[model samples]
Target: MSDGADTGEAGEPGTEARPGLVRRFLLGLIVVLPMSAALIAGGAFLYGKWRFNAPGPAAAPTVVWLAPGHGLSSIAERLREAHVLDETGIFRLAVELNRAAGALKAGEYEIPAHASMADIVRILREGKSIVHRITVPEGLTSQEAMEIVRADPVLTGDMPPVPAEGSLLPETYNFSRGTTRAQIVQRMQKSASALINEAWPHRTANLPYKTQREAIILASIVEKETGLAAERPKVAAVFVNRLRKPMRLQSDPTIIYGITGGKGPLGRPIRQSELDRVTPYNTYQVDGLPPTPICNPGRASIEAVLNPPETNDLYFVADGTGGHAFASSLADHGRNVARWRQVEKKAVQVPVKAAEERTAGTKPVIPLKAPARHVGG
Candidate 1:
């Protein structure tokens, strides 16, 4: 009995120790591999964060333009090409994690100095882009205004179709980087229509304008006659009085529009030869308002023709100042024309610098708008 008990005790020690050895190996494995994996994962995650958040290579405020229809991958490549990023993989992952890959907008963005990838992505997602303003002044022909729009550096895309003359309203318009020229022209047309619709009903009675189109035509002339805002009503009165008698409008702007088709300025003073030249738009030869408006008249100019001040004046000439001198009688008009010639003579004597100051705004110049018929009228 004693020998059998000793042998069982020895076997028990060996069996218990084998189980302990297996338990120790399992515990070590569970602790070691997971901990090692965690350390590696943590290192990768920290590296990604640091790279994505680091400042870009731009030393100054830079403009970044993303064209329309570009995907996130293309944009990322562009950024890397612009030297704005060191690596693109992290940026891609960050954008995906934020679910912003499809939300990028096309526009010109003014990125700050040292902008991080996250900063750029946030800006692109939010569409915080650049805004540019273009102001179209009153009385510009559609062609002239379009020239300005075409030359603008802010707008993009192909040049839009030129609308009918006097279709666009004169005002300041705002646009983003990728805004098309056609879009701006369409906007102007809408604005002009609104102004016309608003002011058409308020025009004076017996205006001799058979249609709203005729009034707009007359308003365009009034706009071209003078640059003075205060003079618009008086200018409108001259045309209105003549129209009351149904006399020839005989405006010089009509003569110029006939010559150039509103595509460019006459670039010189009107001559007697050009005045006698018969054209559809020439008011001297035509009986009524021209076929269409000569230029895009502003709201005030349109308003002036719609509600002109009371006056008996039928003729006007420049009063040596920017404004015009008015007269009711043909004799008085002739006298005014004579004085205007004298003023013109004296103006020719002006120093080049002084003349430069007189028309410094570079608005179209009107020279010798009056001829023999205007003096007689």
Candidate 2:
């Protein structure tokens, strides 16, 4: 029994004592070493990513003023140098990624320094830049347009040599502040070209004018001749018919344009002597269309020339109601003219003035008789 007990305690078959010291040490090492290595590698990876991905401190706000004609590379460099972008290469990459490389608009922009690449890309892509609006009214000469551009605070630089009269189309144009006057003038020229090209395709056939420029010149005359919108086509037709018959246009506005040189507004009414003035632009003296456009014709004026009113009437005179009376025969014109003159005389005889004067005057003043043929035609 003692022997069996000794064998069991020394070399037991079914029971085992605690593991050897070295074996225990190796098992503990096997579990701890890999866990320690994995923890160290994870910490290192996280630190590396944080160090690379984190951006630097916030930068100050910076103003980026983009003058006219500045290219994209110059603007990008400016942003990079201002520290608005950490690297221009990164910015370019971002622009390419967003497909905004070709979408950056030319204008002034304000970017905060140390702005993220994403922010800069958004600003350029969205074109949140400075904007200026210039309104050019109808019937203004190129010189008048230049004066407007020169006077505007948003536009910069001097006007180029004055464009041909009526070459610049009158419309509202949008540009960036600080854009050059020459650039704006060029834009006007382009607009005029485009408008004429587009309108020429739609013009009526068998017209008097051979080319679009002549049509524009005639339309300008018609625009300046009347303030009534409904009369534009009629006035255009009058000129067109006269041109077809090779008769003198005899338009009074042409005479005024010759006298004023298209610099300032003609503040007063036209006179007879001015109408008789001999100038290349004076339709009263010249038989055909004017040498050039007298004023900037608007789209309505252009369309009026393109499609003139169908009428056999050649003579038109103010009917004292903001519209003109059309007459086909001299006799009919005479009657209309007489009626218009009577209306004018009656309008001039103000009721208040006549009543007040009648009480003051002791001797009755004989009213002068208007001439039988003295009427507008």
**Can you give the lDDT of residue 216 in candidate 2?**
89
Candidate number of the best lDDT: 1
Q: On residues 1-377, what C-alpha lDDT tens digit does candidate 1 reach at each position?
A: 99999887776446768888999999999999999999998998898888788888878888878888998889888887776776788999999988999998888888888999988998898997898899999988998899999999877778887889888999999888778888998889999999999889877777777677877888899898888999999889988888888778888888888888988888887888887878888788778788899999999899999999999999887777667788998889888888878877755655554567677865433443332224224
lDDT of 2 by residue, 62-82 (tens): 767654465567767877676
* lDDT against the true structure, each candidate: 0.84, 0.75
Off by over 4 Å in 2: 1-106, 109-121, 350-376
The alpha-carbon lDDT assigned to residue 321 of candidate 2 equals 63
- C-alpha-based local distance difference test score of model 2: 0.75
Model 1: CA > 4 A from native? 1-15, 28-47, 133-137, 149-161, 202-206, 276-279, 329-335, 348-377
Query: Lowest lDDT 10-mer window, candidate 1?
Result: 368-377
Clashing pairs in 1: none
- The TM-score measured for candidate 1 stands at 0.79
Clashing pairs in 2: none
